[model samples]
Target: MSKKGPRLGEPASLVRMRVVPIASVMFASALPLMLPMIANSPALPPLGLLFFLCWQLLRSEMWPVWIGLPLGLWDDMFSGMPFGTAAGLWTLASIAIDYSSQRIYWRGFFHDWAIAAFLVAIIQSLAALIAHPHAPMGRVLGLIVPQIVISALLVPLFMRLTGKFDNFRLKRR
Candidate 1:
């Protein structure tokens, strides 16, 4: 017989199957803080948001609707936004994706990319508004252009990584 899964009676641990996705998401949330690079613009790419969206899209229904709450709270600890901003925005995005996924089916790579770009823009816009309530809407959105572009472009990379992590997470140990 060909070798594929765990041999004969070797069973996979539930925790073993789970650690990859959870760890990858946690690592993504913490990465920006750990990096030493400083940018001229205050905007840094939103890696935590990017990773969360990718995973949710690739594995729809894998997480509950409130998953974003704790993850966003975790992100809040590292992300320097005024508290509860990421939490609200993340939960909103999660809700939006849940509703949209029910209406759409047969997503190809480009479709996923488009959906991600739209959500990223929406998330960044709302975040900008929340963070800069007094600023003119135009300026607030303008300031976030670099952040939106960077986050949007990185969608494919995050999506690819999500798929790999997803596949590995289910592979037989």
Candidate 2:
């Protein structure tokens, strides 16, 4: 091993474990916003939130309850939502997912996907409402329906990606 630790190409230091996951989550959280999109749409979906949930569902206790605060704050910086929106919602989602994990014994792929879909719907719906407070709930939902559908559909893909990242993170030098 190198003096500091593993070499550049070697596996990450999972003995600590926090660094890898935190870094990945932060990057994914900002990624969608980083891209220079000529036209942005509601259907773009919250890939960041999906990624975060995928990690939590994959490893139920990997993060502490407060994990969401800093990461969601990071997301808030890029998300352009009235700051703290992501912080509050992600923190809440983290708690709900944790509670569900405890209540449900079996967490199969489909089951997790369904759960993820529901959370995405709730999050997007709430965000839409926040963005358009005076508008009718129906109108807000209409605007965010595509986003919910797209995010919910991509849950499996995000899970798969999370698995890959987890594997890489856990590998030893």
Candidate 3:
């Protein structure tokens, strides 16, 4: 007789899949604050964090409200923007991702990175314009271009690392 224990084809029985999403949210919430500390280098684009958040939301494995609120608060606190603004934008972005996830397939790393860049650019530009309307367009473009380029280059590696970590955790569970 064959053993009836958990088998490869058996459906996963675990109920609490909260750890991965929670950890991801916390990590993303903290990332912006850490960005300024790295000196003598191009700024890290916020898109990478945004991308991870979107990916987690699309997985549909957690309450977006729970994930969105605190992460937004964290971004607000760390970013020099008015309190709650970043959080609001981030929460909105997550909601948008959740709604569109079914139509969008994150198949290739480049595609994902491109989406991240576009979203990040839009959000950052909006924030900059809102926060400092008088700021020169040149300055905004200057800051954005390099960050976008760097993020575009770096996102695939970050995605791979995060994906690996998630897979490891899932396998262990």
Off by over 4 Å in 2: 1-12
> Over the stretch 1-173, how does candidate 1's per-residue lDDT look in tens digits?
78766777675667856677667877888998898988755567888889899988888788887888888888888877778888888898889888888988778888889989999999888877887899998888778888899889999999998988877777667
lDDT of 2 by residue, 113-135 (tens): 99889988888788777867899
lDDT of each: 0.84, 0.82, 0.61
> Candidate 1: deviation at residue 107, Å?
1.6
Instruction: Looking at model 3, report the run of 10 residues with the lowest lDDT sum.
Output: 10-19
lDDT computed for candidate 3:
0.61
- Which ranges in model 3 have alpha carbons more than 4 Å from their true place? 1-16, 31-42, 57-66, 105-108
- Which candidate number has the best TM-score? 1
Which TM-score value belongs to model 1? 0.89
lDDT score of model 1?
Answer: 0.84
Which is superior by lDDT, 1 or 2? 1
| lDDT score, candidate 3, position 42 | 36
Best by lDDT: 1
